[model samples]
Target: MKDAKNVTITDSEWMVMRAIWTIGHATSRELIDAMNELEGWSASTTKTLLHRLIQKQAVAQHGGSRPFTYKPVVGEKESMAAAADDLFDHMCAMRAGSTIAGVIQSRELSRADIANLQAILAEKAKTAPEEVQCNCLPGDQTC
Candidate 1:
């Protein structure tokens, strides 16, 4: 399966995406106006951002008015997960062990989050055989 669509946002595009995500839905004019205050952007800039978002399948458009209304096409969870995966992939590709260690060390988890992650790890460990396994190959190990 493909990764989630939302993390596809570029740094610049994220500003636009946040606006759309926050509004849920807004007219292009409204968006442009909103961005002008935060970014001092021109209408054309907002329009370009909209086009980029549409191309990425991150934003949805509707209405036949002069300016269409746009909304976020990706759900919040999908967006967050994709963002996390993207960051993880970058870190892994760079230096896997250090990246993982840094994440564990740096993250500020709530009690619930810590408990949940611990429970999940325990469950996986219990269900899994002793060795770490790859299920992709024909001679796959215990996965």
Candidate 2:
């Protein structure tokens, strides 16, 4: 399986990548035609993005020929997950403990969200010793 990189792409690139992910392997012309309505992007713009994607190793091309077929090197799900994680990590590092505290203190959550979060915490609290991978720092007491 291909490892997903924490690669950040522009909004335009994300639009194209999402479409390509949904559309499967395609040629530049096919991608441009399919995305034109959504992005109002010209064929040349699409070609440019394909070029950048290839350079980033996120997209691979058919043996360099006219109307070459291009496919994503990373799976859509993995890429999406990695991007979300990167975003969360950035936000956490920026806000420090306040980010987590805010989530814990929020009282306006929907019933479903609160219930699900409670269930997750309950499950974590009951985790057996053998299944635990403690990350408690020095001087920090074990749960």
Best model number under TM-score: 2
Off by over 4 Å in 2: 93-143
Q: For residues 1-143, what per-residue lDDT tens digits would candidate 1 score against the true structure?
A: 22355338777788888888788889988988998999999999989988988888788789877668888877767877788776765532334445666787898989998899789878977776544333343563332
RMSD of 2: 6.7
Candidate 2, residues 1-143, lDDT tens digits: the string is 35776456667778778877888888888899977888788989988988887777778888567978888887888888887677665542334345555857975778898899889868967863534332343444343
The CA root-mean-square deviation of candidate 1, after full C-alpha superposition on the true structure, stands at 5.4
Span of 10 residues, lowest total lDDT, candidate 2: 128-137
TM-score of 2: 0.65
Best by lDDT: 1
Model 2, C-alpha of 72: deviation from truth (Å)? 0.9
The lDDT, on a scale of 0 to 1, for candidate 2 is: 0.74
The estimated TM-scores of all candidates read 0.64, 0.65
- Supply candidate 2's per-residue lDDT for 8: 62
